[model samples]
Structures are given as C-alpha cells and as structure tokens.
Target: MAGAGWAPPRLDEFILTEPLGSGTYATVYKAYRKRDTREVVAIKCVNKRSLNRASVENLLTEIEILKTIRHPNIVELKDFQWDSDHIYLIMEFCAGGDLSRFIRTRRMLPEKVARVFLQQLACALKFLHDRNISHLDLKPQNILLSSPENPQLKLADFGFAQYMSPWDEKHVLRGSPLYMAPEMVCRQHYDSRADLWSVGVILYEALFGKPPFASRSFAELEEKIRSDRAVETDLVVEAVRKDQEGDASAAFSLYRKALEYFVPALHYESDARRKEAIRAKVRQYISRAEELKVLVTSSNKNLLEKGNPARELLKEMAKDKPRLCAALEVASAAIAKEEEGRDDSDALELYQQSLGELLLLLAAEPAGRRRELLHAEIQTLMARAEYLKDQIKMREAQSMGKEALAESVRSGCTLQ
Candidate 1:
C-alpha cells in the first residue's frame, strides 16, 4: 500500500477506464490514480455481500500473500480499499493481457520465446516455493505479460495459493484439472512439487500447442494426469527443443525429470527386452547431458569473449562443470570397454572432443583460483586421453596382426 492512507479512499480517487475481465468472485478494471493521471493500475473489485465465508477468507489470503511477496515476475499489490459494498485491490496493470490469450493468437510460441518465459516463471516459482508458498493454480490464464512486444510474464491470480510447511500434507484439490498434479487429482498428500508439476504442464502446453493431459471431460483429464500417459515422449521433445534454443538449464532440468521415469522402469523391468529398452532410454538421457554440456560451453565461450557480466551463468558452469566432466569420462570408459574387440574410434573421438571443450574454458579464464582448478582438470583429462590413445593403438596393432596371420594361412592353403 504505497500511497494508501490509514483510511480507505473513495472510488472517486480513481478513474475507472475499461473492464479488464470478470471472474467468479471479482471484476478487474483498468484504472488510473486521480492524483497522477499518468499512473495506471488494475483494480480488482470484489463484492463483499456476494461471497460466502470461505470465499472471503480466500480473498483475504490472496491479499496477505500478495502483500508479503514482491518480485519482478509477480504482479505487485500497490493499494487496497475496503468499503461496505466492495473490497478493491489496486495492482500493477499488465497491458499485454494473459498468456492464454497470447498463446491462442500465436497457436504456440517459438522455442526461444517460450524458453525465456519458462525461465522467468521458474525463477518466480522458486522464490515462492523457497518461502513455503504454493500457488496451487498455475496456468497460462494466470500468467500476465507486461506488454505485447516485451512479453515479460508476471504471475497473477493467487486466490488458490496456500502457505504450507515442507512436511505438511495437502489432500485438497484446488486447481484446474488440466494443470493439476497427479497427487492433487488423486486426493493424496502433496506439497510444492505439485506446483512444479503444473509448471511441466504449462511448459508442455507452451511447446505442443495443447496441454499434455487434455480431455473433453474432467474425469478423463484426471485419469490422464493420474496415469501421466501423455508426458513421456512430449517431455523428451520439449527438452530437446529447449536445448536447441540454447537454454541449457531448462533443457537439463527437463531431461533429468524424464530420466526419473526411466529409472523406475529399469528397476522393475523383468523381461530382458524391456530392460534393454529402458537402458536405451537411459542412454538418451546421457546424450541429452552431452548436448547440454556442448551448448553451455559454447555459450560460456561467447560470454567470455564479449566480456559479459553474467556472474550467474559463470557460477552455474563452475558448479556443474566437474560433474559433467566426470559423467563424460565414465561414458567414454564404458563405451571403450564395450567396444574392446571392435573399432573403438567413436568412443575415443567422443572422449577427445569432450576433453577439448573442457580445455577451451581454460583459455577464457584469467589466472586465479578457478583457473588453477581448471589446470588441475586439464592435467587429469590429458592423462585419461593418453591412456585411451594407447588402448586404441594396442587394439589396432592386435587387429592388424590377426589379419596378417589370416592372410598367411590363405596363402599356404593356396600353395598346397
């Protein structure tokens, strides 16, 4: 309540221009402060007499949550007024409308644009979840864009939001069926993970032009969510799309979630063929990891060359670089062993290329603590590369010797 006084202001203090929209409990209006005509805001007017006790409590809860949280990607609550007839909430006006309308006009957003919005939404949700708040209802209709051109998203509509502890169990279903988590649909205990599941649904809709679990009826939709049948292939495609759009973090996060499904399938699989199929799925995750690493390294190089001041990007790379390098080493060794009696050129090439990408980072860094660590990594990789090269050469020599012996045996047989 930045400019609000102790008492509620008269409706005359604002000039209501046009009706933004109407909801079940409230009507939104585009309005301006009378004192400053240049300043515009959205007024959500809720009729007090029109609601039951539960609805009133929910409205008050929204106000409480909105007042406590302030973020760039979250709509701001600037002022409020309580009168005998109505409760007016003054909020930041978003001229670009909600994301649902935006998506409707475009059919589906381009991968780059969707990736940007998803990252922003993830950051906003992370902020809320870190503070123990669950939005409970997250969808395109609730995501407002700042403007048509910029399309900066702001999370709105907190009527169903709840504040819960990490260990608290939630069994109440309080969201749209299409966006609801499986636990929510099943009336089982859930937590902040439900919001993340909603995010996945939103991401799917953004990418595929329709919700993954879409159905004509609520029952069918619930069944789809409970089974999570539509998400398997779509998740992988969306992950790869994000990687192509150069959003390594989002791509990696999606791939990691996809990997979770395969892990359970692999564990419970009794049939050898089905187990092999699960192993192939696991290998896809490994491939995604490698692709993400390549994208991250390329972006890091560009940032370094341009002298960009994106410390967060640098921090992410530094944090994950070791684990990524270790995975690559393990994959290389496994492939080499698997191809021991055959040509292991592909495995050797993969090892060398991944090592080269790691070494490239050393050139971009100045001599410091980080550079020192990179030097140590380079030493380790060089040793591994040498060992792999020797193995390849020995295999090749053995192969050549066997060929020569076969040739001699053929010649002796012909002479006989």
Candidate 2:
C-alpha cells in the first residue's frame, strides 16, 4: 500500500460494504461507519456524469421532499457525503430490500401480508393527504419492508412527491408508466384525488396477480393509460343517467360490471328494472366504498384498530411476519412501554395498524361519525410519520466490501 495512496477516494468516511442494486443512473450499496462502531447503513451512489437536467431536478426534488417530510412509509434520508467520483446519499438500510424483488417472483403477496402493507400505507397516505402531499409514483418498486415482524412499509423514492392543497391540482405527467393515473397521463389538473386513483391501481395489483393494465411494451401501456375505455362505474353512471344519451351494448356491460354496486342507479330500457337496478347497485357501491374507509371516528374513542382482510387473501403474503399473528403481543408491549413515560410515540402505532386494516376493506361505507374526521387524521399522521423517518441515522465510513459478504445470506432476516 503506497503511503500517498492516490488520496484514497474521500468517502473512505464510509467503507463500501455491499452493493444493494444497480440502475442506469444510481447504484445502491450497503455501507458502514468507519468511526462509530462500524454501524451499518445504505448508500445511494448517483453517477453525476450521466445526470442530465431532469435527473438533477429529480435529485433536488428528492432532497427537498426528504427534508420536509417523515413517516413510517416514506424512506428516511440519513446524510449526504461526496467523493472525487460521485455523490452519496446515505439512508436507513431496509434489510428486506426493494418491493420490486418481492413482487417480481411472487407476482402478489398473501392477504395477511398485503393487509399489513396496505394498512401502514393508508395511514401514511392519510398523513400526506392531510398535509396536501401527493406521492405521484406509488408502486411496489418504491415500497420497502425493513422489519419483518414490525415491518415498516417505507415509501421509497420521492422524486415525484408534490405538495397539493385540497383544492390545488398538480398538472404534471410523471411517474412509472405502469402506475400512472389516467388523469395524470391526460394532463388534467389533479389533487389528492389523484393519489386515490393511484391507490386504485395499487389495489388492483394487490387484488389481482398483475397490474390491471399490464402490457407487453412501453408504447402499448402508454396507449392504454391515454384511453383505457374500460368499464369504470363513474363513467357508466354518466352514460346511463336519465339525463344523458349514449348507447353501446359492450360498453354498458363493461360499465355494469365495473359499477356492480349501482344496479338501481344503473337502468335498462325497462323502467321497472331501472329503479330496482339503480337501488341495488347504488347500495352495493355505497357499501363497498365505505368499507374502503381507513379510519372511523366514533364518540367511544377506541384506539386499537384491526388489519385489512383483503391483504390477508394475498397468496404469497408472509406467514412468519410478526404483526400478522402477534398484534396483541405487539400492542401489549407497546402499551406497557408507552405507559413507562417515554415520548407518546405510540400515539399512531395503533392508528397505523387499524387504518391499514380499514383501507384493505375498500367497501363503500355510509358517512358517519367514524370517518367524518378521517381526512384530518390522515394529514396529522403524515406529519408524524415524516418526523420518525427523518430521525433515522446514517452510518459513518468503513471497509464494507469484505464485511458485506455475510449480508448475502438470506435467513432469519431482522433489522440490526
């Protein structure tokens, strides 16, 4: 080893431990701190040489978004460091890796696992919508599960998270081609509701084995987004309304199936059938939509809520994940720990668990005291989630190449 050692790449501050993944513009590697007991972390190395204006804008957006928000679902930005070769953004090492890998082989997760995932996700979404933050790019690729037991469904990659007030609509076409909403593709002014649209796409994927719009090629997929012409219940209602005029048998059946709840609102040529169908379908949708509610506010004020059942149905959902079978144990321990007078952090754990369950239901529910203030709680929880995410620490530099070999072993995976 030469004494000069060619100035030894400045980021010796963090010894490169293991490579998590490699993409066109960035490479993610697990690393550790050189000074602090060699603590472990993940480092995202973006080759500035290949970065263009759009990439730079995305990087800046990521930094800005991470700076402002924190939540259990959103990935945390630990620190920033650089060297002669490239820039490094250190973050919490989510041992489970990216959801892309999880979904790649399995296609879909089991309902129990999906329930745990959706619940936390809804809680985070409620938090973001309350604060007017819309995550435009919400897909499995951007979700990471760090702790299998108390798995944190961290919403990773925030290059597209934008702030939108209840009334403000963000007019931008950006996101993974597969998960992009119809309006977002059509250049329409959209707000929090757009997030709901994306949620619908995620829901479809969670329910079915593949994306509702999965295609063979990029161009073909984009065309579908531009003009799906599928049977959307809302579209059906407009077409079949007593006030409107449009008749096509196939589209009608498609709409009928899509709007399964609007049998009464959905009328045919016969007036007698119209009222009965409308009443039945409307009631059905109304009930189903209500079931989708993530939170319910009753005067009784019960805090601990259940998990989502739809996720429990996922064929590939994990069987050993602690949250599934040990809700009572986790809750009991949390309560005991919280009662010990630590910071009131348990404030939202129950909320996250229960909200996750409700979102899993996805049924139309009648408006009542339970969900009247749900919109506000969603916003409140978003803020709290952001805080917890930001508090995560970044490890210092250390020699990780040789050490990371052990991480390749897949078993008994638990967060250190």
Candidate 3:
C-alpha cells in the first residue's frame, strides 16, 4: 500500500480509472480490461488491513452468494483476485450509476416508472429468496442501473447478505438503520422478512422522495425505529387531522403513505393478539381510504366531464358505425364509473367489454385517422383498466398483509 495517499494497488489485468464508490471496507473503481477485448467492469478493492474476523466472514459470504447466483436483475460477479494488500472483485459495469444518484437527480420518480424499477428489484429478490439468500443491506445506493436511457435495475452490494430462510432467525444486527426493520434495529432476532421491510422502504423512497425514518442523526433515526407505535400513530393522527379539516387530498395521500409502513409493522409484530388487532385497524383504515378515494374522485367528476374532448372525438368518429358508436358509449359510462370511484370491478368489466368491440372494429377498419383515433382511445381505456386492476389488487393485498402483495409482485403476476 502507498503509505499516505493510499492509491489503489496496480493490477496487470485491468486499467482502473475513476472511483465508483467507497465504503468502510472497500472501494469500487470503474475499469477496463487491458487485454484485446477491453471489456468494462467495476472492480471492488477491499484493503486486507480492513478485514476483521466478522468482515472476513461477510466477504466470504458475499463472494459465495454472488458466484452462485445468475439473474438478469442482479449484478454479475465475473471473477475475483487478491494480492498482499487488497482483494478485488470484478463485477458487471452499470453505466447508469446507482439508484441513490438516480433518485437524487430526479428528486422523485413518477409512480409508473418507479413501479417498473420495483418490479425488476422484486424479481431479483424473488430469485434470492428462492435460494434462501437474504440481501440484508438493500438500499438505493446499493442498487445499480444498467444505463441512463431505458435503464434497468440491477441489485448490487451483497456485503451483508446471508443464506437465511423465512424460518431462520439471527440476533446479530445488519443493514442500514434507515432501511432496517424494527426488529433488526432493536437488536432482536430477525428473519428474512426483514429484507421485505427494506423493500418497502425502497418503494416508499422511490414514490415519496425520501426514506420514512430519515433523520439528521443516528440517534433520531434509532428513536423513530424503536418507537414504532409512536411513528405509526403520528402519521394516522396527522391524517385524521387533515381529514377533519376537510383536506381530503392531503389526508388521502397521507393515509396511503401510512399504509406502506403499517403493512410492514403488522408483519413484524410477533404477538398473535396484537397482530390481529393491528390487522383490524389496517382494515378500517383501508375502508376509510377507499371512501376518501371515492370522495376525491367524485369531487373531480365534473372536471373530468368538462375536459373530455378526446372521448367526444371518438364518439364523433364512430357515428356511422352503430356498433362502434355503441361501444364508445359504453366506454364513456365506464369512464364516469371510474371517475365516480365506485365499483372498480364494474368499471373494469365495462372496459373489457368495450375494448373487445373496439379492437374488433379497429382491426377491420382501414389505416386512417378514424382507425388511429380509435386505437388511441383503446390505449387510454386499457391504461384506465390497468390502473383499476392495480387498485383492486392493492385493496386485496392490504387485506392479506404485505407478504401477499410482495409475493404477488415477485411471482411475476404484476410484471405481466
């Protein structure tokens, strides 16, 4: 090692360039192969001096897990090497940088875009779960993006990972405090579901722009995690305050945000009676949220009716074709039902019925403005139908708890 400057050790196989990131134990550098192919990679260099017994164990576990796993959404470890001073891990290069930078650059991601990333991450987690591997340190900084344009998520950083099954439990604390489950933060026995709690945090950050327990100091964050009930109650009390003040929009948003934490809280609760009681409250909250959604939607119905020129255009274009016109009318009713926020299932069925007819008509029609307009209308209806499907699925998942929702996503049902 260079005494003071601590320059990365020279290697014969690759030309290391800029530093990608650094942590307590290692520094990752962007590098290119020195051979004919000149393939790019990220090389993690761990100083031998930094490896205490626990860290050495963690390093071995990381290598073992990365070497055995092969998934599109998880970073690939091509090879590793070591010298007197440092151990190096050569990994697949992701040009888009880590998710922490991605989120910071954008401030907050749109829900649709965030959901895509979440789906990819969920798929990767599902792969690990199947093999009984738990990525204990899951966070945006540890997740990579394939490239800037049309970026794909790649789960990276397995330094704290372990092969722990759902039934397996450990008392040793692991993972970032902000993203850690209450059990882990409180230094109690925790299982693989702790990773799921981290996932919920990631999802929340993606949608809302920051982790729920973010604080200026570690002590503040620990207090928030330890006083789980206080945190949960604060959100609910504030939401109720807003609801009483007639700020349905803000209240609705807060209620939804609270549910994100509430689900994980319910999952982490060990006592059967307490869990059942919390579940009942969650159900009550879900019911109230549904009512608020309808209230919010009904308040916006007139605005929806007034500005819907696109629907009018579709109706005008289908005037000559009575069947198409009838389908368009049915779609209009579906839109109204959706805007009313009552009977989402009815709205979905109506969309399906109209889409069936519109698609048949669209296929038979020639390539002209009418066909184009009709196709566009079909796309709009499909989006609405899909949104309704998601909403319905969310309500059902809330009833069953976080595991069911996460499992549904991981099973590729939502991905399709």
Candidate 4:
C-alpha cells in the first residue's frame, strides 16, 4: 500500500481515487461513496503483508479506540472493513489537509489564529482526558482541518493513543522524537502530562514557525532538550500566555516587559507595513495591560460582581419571561468573556448579539422593575461596546507627532 504502483484496494460501496498520504503500513485515499449523495470520505488501506506484530496490535487498538469515542474536534472513523489482503478504515474527509501543511504554507500563524487552533486542540484533549485516553502522538501532521475556508481543527492519527489516565505512568517510548516530551525521551515514567508537553511544542511551532529545538541531528535535538541552558524567551509570547491563564499580575508585568522590547523594535524597524502591525499590537497590549493594572489593584471578582445585584434582580423579575431570561444569560456570558480578557473582539461581538435581543424585548415590556433592570443592563453593554471601539481605534492610529518628526528629519538629511 505504501510503494508506487500500488493501486488502492477496491471497496464494494466506495470508489477510491488518488492517495492522500502514505505511511509504513497503509495509504490513505480520497474516496467517494457510490450512493446517490456521493459523499466524500478517506479510506485508509493497510496492506496485510506490511503489518508487523506490534503494528497489528496498534491497528486493532486504534480501531477499538476510534469506534468507541466521538467528539467534535476528533476525526470520526465512520466504518472499518478488512478483506484477505487489506484493511480499510473509512474516515471523515478533511478538505484542508493536515496542520503541518497549513503551517508550512503560511510560514507562521498569527497569534490570534494560533490561539484559536490551540483552543480547539485543548478541547479535543479534554474530551480524551475525560475518557481516560491519552493521544501520545500529538503532532501537526496528525491534525486535520475540516475545510480550506474557516477550517475547524480535527485531531487524527491515534495509532499511538492509549487508555492511560492522568496518574497512569508508562515507561515505553512512543511518539515523534521532535515533539516528544523530555520525560519520554529520558526513559523516565510519564503520564498524560506528556501529551501536554507535546501541546506546548505544537503551540510553539505554530507561533514561531518552528519548534524550540529544531536541529539537523538527533544529538543536537537531545542536547537542546537535555542541556542546562534555558530556551530564549519572547516577552510578548510570555505576556499573552499569562494573560490567557488569567494571571493578571504576572501578565501585567510581562506586558510591561514586552513594551520595553517593542518600543525599541518599533524605532529600529524600517519596514513600514511591519512597523504599523507592531505599533497596533503594542497599543492593544497597552490597553490590556492598563486593564490588568486595575484588575490587580481590585479583585476581578468585585469588578465582575459589581452589577450582580442588578442582574440577580433582573433574572428574578423576568421569571415569567423565558426569552428575556435567556437574553440576560447571554449578556452575562459576554461579561464573563470581557473579564477573562482573552479576546476583546469576541467579547464585543457577544455583547452586540446580546444587545440586539435585549433591546427588542425591552420595547415590548411595560415600565416595571424588570424593564428598569433590563434598561440598565443595556446601558452597561453599550458602554462596553464603546470602550472596545475606542481600543480598536487607538490601536489603528499612527501618531501624527512621530510622523511629523520623521518628515522633518528626512528634509534635514536631504538639505545636508
């Protein structure tokens, strides 16, 4: 199934086309069902002769695991069949290919885009964690995208996965070398946390365009991982990590450190487009850092719960109105997002959606306690919307004073 001229084994109900990918024992093909709908699928054709004893066991384990579990972010195994010469695994087709190709084509992903993918990956991992499953082989090549446009991440290639709980430690080495956790490589016992280390590597590769220890030889990679020297850190990346983790105090400090680096980088950068992007990101971080400063001084809980009394009263008053209560809940969720400070744009969009529903409901209701509370909630959401708009505007603006100063310097140089 792996070598050239190896035709895909015929399936009774599906027509196999070109090969999508090839591995040691199998080749995946893009196929279509023979039914009127002609639905698309991926068929993994594993040549019987290619399977070693261990690979045979892995295949059986993979089939058992995939058949029993289902999650939104995990690739679905629709069906499995085996003939005398080959085994066929019918899977959901992903049009966007694998994450490795996606990143390779882009060179590197924007932080926002990388964060979105990380979130999806984490979601899938959580599902596995709940079921006491660990995907030991977590790498970009094993991750699939649902489609080319606005693709959804799908975790695939679970041949190395196992029914290991968080506390279950294993000494057997598994997974790709570059993406493997240090414990696994050192021949030490490791549990589900090994998968997390791989996740960190995936995120690092996504943001930086390469893993932390990209090397030409096995010795170089091992030395980098096992050496005493700390890997060079990026201030902005550190700041964002802390911010996402809700460590406002640490994030505030890191953001300030990032600004120290960004200011000099901005001044030194000659590329106008790159400078503008950096300037905008600096402004956004500045806004978030200022917000974090206040959050550090005051309890984030207090800031969030400041309006809880009114919200509680509104919820109680709107007991008779299910639609109104649902809208109020959506508004609450939007507030939570804003407080998290993970993505202001997402928070703003949520606020807009919630406001649209609340405004209509308010107009329908007569003047009363519920109406009064609803009105207050609407005003609060409007203020948040305005604040987010100002943040966006500030991030976009190029300083007039700086531009004028540069113009004067250029004119002086010309005269000289």
Candidate 5:
C-alpha cells in the first residue's frame, strides 16, 4: 500500500516541489532547487522500516556507482540528503513515464526507433559492465526518456546493481525475477553479464509486446527460467552441441544464474578492487570447442551478442553443475508418476501447492541467507505458472484480434 499523505512533507532546503509517482516503499516526487538553473529533478522519499534491508545496502552502492559515473546516457544523480527517519535521493526528472509505457502505447516500435534506444542503452550498459558495475535491474520502468532540450533515454534505478569492484561476493539474489538470467535461476555468485540477460528480456518485450519470461505467479515464472523453455534465439546461432543435461535437470541452473547476474559487471569496470570481489563461487559461462566466436549478419548485428562469451561457457558447465540435479530428478519423477495416473491424495496436492506457494513467498523476500537460490527457485516456478495462464489467455483472444482486424478492413482502415 502507498502512503495516503506525505510523511513530514517538507523537503529539505535543497529540494523544492511535489510528488511525481507513488510506490509501496518509495514516493518519487518532482522537485527543484532554489539556487540552480537545473531544477527539474525527482526526489525519492523512502520509508526506512518498510524497505528490504538489502535494498538499503544496494542504495548505498548506487551512490558509490553514481559518484563515479559521468555518462550522458546514465541519469545524473545530483545529490543525496538524509534527515533522521527519511532519505532524500535527488535525480534528473524524466517527463516521459518509462520505456514500458512508451512501448506499450505503440505496440511494436519501429526498428529504427528501437535501434536508437538500444544504442544509447547498450553504450551505458557497456560502460557499467566495463566498470564492474552490473545494473541487475534493466527493465523499462527503470529507463526514462525525456522530451527536453537534449532528448534521450536516461538509465535510472541502481538498486539492483552489483558492485564488482569491492566484495562482489556471492550474496543473495537481487533484481526482478522476470528479468533475471537463466543462470541466476539456481544459486551462484554472479557478475556483470547478467545485465545482458536483462537487456535480452527488454529486447524480447520490444518484439513480442511482453516479456519472454513472464508469469501470473512468482513460482511459475521461476519454472520457466530454470528449464530449457527459455533457450531461444534472439539472433540465429548455430547449435554447436546440446547441453547433455536434459531441460528437467537443474545442474547448470546455478551456473545460469551466475551468468545471468554477474558477467554484465565485467564489461566496463576493469578496476581491481572490484575484481577482488568477483568471488570463486561465480561459475563461468560454459565453453565449447572449435566454433566461430561470432557471426556477422543482419540479425547478429556485427556479432555483438556473441562478444560476451559467458553464456556459451556456462553451457559447458552444464555437465559439471550438480547442486540441483538430484532434487530436479526427484521432482521430475513425481511429475511423471502424476502424469501416468498416480493417485494424488488431497493431502499430497495441498502439500505440493503449499510448497510452491511458500517458494514464491520466499522469492518475493529480498532477505535471507540463500536469497539467490531461493529467489531462483521461486521465479522458476512462478514463470511456469505465468506461462500456462498466458497461454490460456492468448488462445481465448486468438480469434478476437483476427475478427477485429477483419471488421476494420471491411470498414476500410489500415491493418496497422
């Protein structure tokens, strides 16, 4: 629930303005400065007690990351202030709501428009990756475009970024589960490349009008990311060989989560302090022998996606990853038996359903020791459930769109 009225409404002397949007834990308000010509800004007021403890830590890391960044593509973090119970984070204000709404209204964005947005975003991400800072949350909601003197997209929200510079240890999982990488679905230390998977999700949404990994529930979503169902081509890639482990196997799930979260950190910051924190637990993406590192084509776009060898390397790791293998085997057997007409006692049904529900509740939890693994499992399950529900909805709406299009054509309107 959101706060009905502002708590201690007066902004510090430095800030000036009113609320922009309301969120459960934080309220983003449009603010301005008395002294500066550049007064267009957003002040986020957060209730300390309601936030996840890690979110606070991540907020501090965001400050550190922002202090070092001077990129045009990234949002400028103007200042920070704290007064007792509240923290005031002031950033450049974006009039445009978010990329999500922008794309949603237009349905499919033109390739040229997408190329422009992707270019700046990729450049900003490239900078973060090089600096060992992984913006783990790269969803459209975090990206703001401005129709200003200098119109452009500015990447915001560093809450989910991992600082690979200092103590990039294998901590609990972070970021929205929907945008998480396949490796992060299991438990593992992750790096900068995980940001790439997020970018991949955004791209998928750009093309399909929704996310590739989606769900009505959190557990079902996790199921989707954990399995091979998400292993699809954004651009065509020659299959070198299959990851011998079957889709049901969770062997490389941890490895997938690792690449999903961490590798994106390595693209920009080659700083050593961050390098020290990269952690041994961060499983490298699998590698295969005797293949071209990349191919250049219209789809491949100068072989950009292949440049990050992390995911491919993880595929090789599929053979050695064993943490979830046994559990997955057991779970798969249970499924098979149920499919083959094994009786499901009411108690058994209740237990299995409760287990899934509990996992999802845990996934929403940002606290806990094995947050990464727990979140992975929760998301995997949720993704699966979400997929089934979405399939049903799509089937129901399948003919409606066609009929509407036919009616429109009959009435003489352009198909688009």
Candidate 6:
C-alpha cells in the first residue's frame, strides 16, 4: 500500500552493499532495494556541495538523455532521488563489468567477437543518430557487459552525449583523444560520422589487438590518425575500380585479398552474431566474383571450349540456391547477348541451364509473393528457350538449302 502521504524513500532505502568504482564526478555502489532485497542496482551518488555550476549542468544533461533513450543495448536508468546534499541515480547493475576490463583480461578479442560487439554498437549508434543524439564519448570503458556467461553489452555513461542537427555548424571538441575522429582532433566542426570513426577505431583495436594509431604524445597521435592509411580500405577501392574496368580476374583477386584480412578475426571469434556478419560479407564477395567470372568467360569461345571455368563456378555457387539462381540469370543474359548474329547453341544451353536452376529455386521457395515472382521469371525464361530452339532450327534449314543448291550448280557445270 503506497500513498502520497507515505514518506518518500530515503537514501537508506537502498542499502549499499559494496563500493563498485569512483570517477571524477561521483562514486558508484552496488546496492539492493530494501523493499525487494532481490532487486539489485548500481547507484551513482553525486555530492552536490562539491560540484560547480558546469558540473551540475553536465549531470542534468546525462539524466535528460538517459531518461529519453530506451534501447536494449543502452543501459536502463531505473530510478533517481535528490536530497538537500546529494543526488542518486539507480541504474541496471551489470555484474560482468565494463568492456575495458573484459578487453584487458582477454588481451584481444577474436574478430568474430569484435564483430558481435560492433554490430550491437552500430545498432545503438543508429538508434541514437536517428533521434539526433550524438554520444560524444564512446569508448570501451563506457560499454558494460550484463553477465559473464551470456555477456550482453550495453552502452553507458552519457555525460558527453548531445543532440545536434545536420545543419548545426559549430560543436565543442570533447572525448578521449585515442578514439577521436580526425576532424575532431583538428578542432573542426563534425557531425554523426565522427561517432562512426570512433567505432572504426574500436573495431581496429578489436581485430588487430591494438589501435591503428598510437603515440607517446597526443600531437603525434593526431598526426598519425590523419595520415594513416587502412590497407583493407585501399584494397576495396582498387577492387571496385577493377570491377568497373571489366577486369573480373583482377577484381576477384583484390576482393579475396581484402577478405583475407578478416580471416584471422573470424577464425578466433567465438560469438555467433559476429561470425554471421563476417560470413555474410564473405558470401557477398564470393557471389560477386562468381558473377564477374561468368560474365568474362561467357563471351570467350576459347575459354568455353577449354572446359569453361564459368560453368564450374556456377556449379559451386549452386550450393547456395538463391545465389546460384541469380548468377545463372546474369550469365544467361550475357550469353544471349554475345551469341547474337553468331552460333547460338551456347546461348541456348545457358538458357536451359538457367531455367533448371530457376525451377529448383521455385520449388524451394514457399507460397508467397516471392514464389510468385520466381514463377513469373521461370515462365519468361521458358519462353526465351523456346524462341532459341526455333531460331536454331531455322538456321540449320537455311544451311542445308545452301549446300544442296551449290551441289546442283556444280553438277550442271560438269567441269566446263
């Protein structure tokens, strides 16, 4: 039975069990709500008498931001209390501790595990960005793990978070120097992309066991961050150029090189979410390479006559039926175009093969709009195959007529 006449719960209502940590602003404690002893929370108690005007405003900002944001990956703020001397914020207690501690203990996370963290962090960032919130201070220390066994991550510490519109041109520089973006280090205005740059630093550290740039002095670090080149980024750029230039082999090689960088990460990663993200990228690159190989080899008679590697690639890709069907469709179209005004037997064969793969996909596809689309595509391919058959027959007939006429002419002349 709770009523307005019931006195508000005092600071003693939450019995502090242990000291968790202390920061520049406040000390945190592991505590239990007395009414329900099972309910545990981390209470951040700030002494008001010691704070200046600016500090109080920063504290208020953090509270305002936390109160408005509700996300699974963001720490939950449960309750708050203010007395004449101090303010207390009761938040969800994470028993596993901060990510910084986890990383310190693990040394370097496997790429898969890093990817899992990256995905959740990215999702949290997107959620904040969507609402015009920028977490100016995003670092491993600000991320907490809910439990040791399951290890669900939650972003915490919003003291430096702020709301900024795209049109805003001015912003004060704040955040750890190691994770700061180039623009921020330069003391220039930046936007949400700055947060992504911090995320990139975290990702690099997670994968390589160290940040991309390091220096004894902050100035040197800033210089390194600005000038440092990412090998994978360069490879991706080159791959795209080669792809656009119609050099499928070169492009495929570059993409493979780019993918190799992630192999170590994937091999050591233990998290499923991270593993899947890496795997998805792997599939994308492989599928693209297969598609290009088909295009390059389809028109080359020499390549086809020498045991077409394009066909082999398609056979391999067929293991993933959806990807195989897509590759076959592209190959079929390219072959049809190349065979125009020439022998179309190759094109006819490709069409039939594509039809076969499409039928397999159609069979596997469930009853839905997607199945309907597959059925329509299959019908169109069948019609094209039929047309190719008729054209081939007409061409054969024309060849036979020409040979008979030539023989008659020779017989009439009789070696005159």
- Which tens-of-lDDT digit does each residue in 354-410 have in candidate 3? 999999999899998888888878887776676566567557545666563454345
Tens-place lDDT digits, model 5, residues 1-416: 23585343466455555666666667788776767584678887877776687777877888888877988889888888877667778888788778888889878566678778888999998888778788887898888887633459889888767767534655467777788766565656766677888887887677546787678756787777655322332211212123233321122232332233333333332443343233211222322110111111122222224322432332233244343333333334433443343443432343356345445445454565444444444344343333223323333332333343344346544323
Tens-digit per-residue lDDT, 332-364, candidate 6: 574556457475677777777777767776677
Best lDDT goes to which candidate? 3
Model 6 TM-score?
0.54
Least well predicted 10-residue stretch by lDDT in candidate 2:
393-402
Q: Per-residue lDDT of 98-210 in model 2, one digit per residue for the tens?
A: 66666556765665777777888899889878877777888877788786455678887776777778888667677776787766665677676776777767755764456
> Residue by residue across 223-258, what tens digits does model 1's lDDT show?
765552324555578888998887785676566555
Model 4 agreement with the true structure over 167-278: per-residue lDDT tens digits: 8999988899889998887778999889999998999788667787877766677789876443433666777888899987677766665554455445655655555555
Q: What lDDT does model 2 reach?
A: 0.56
- Model 3 scores a TM of 0.58
lDDT of each: 0.72, 0.56, 0.82, 0.81, 0.57, 0.70
Against the true structure, candidate 5 has what lDDT?
0.57
Give each model a TM-score.
0.55, 0.51, 0.58, 0.57, 0.51, 0.54
**18, model 1: CA deviation in Å?**
1.5
**lDDT score, candidate 1:** 0.72
Best by TM-score: 3
Comparing 1 with 6 on lDDT, the higher-scoring candidate is: 1
On lDDT, who's better, 2 or 3?
3
Query: Total clashing residue pairs per candidate?
Result: 0, 59, 0, 0, 54, 0
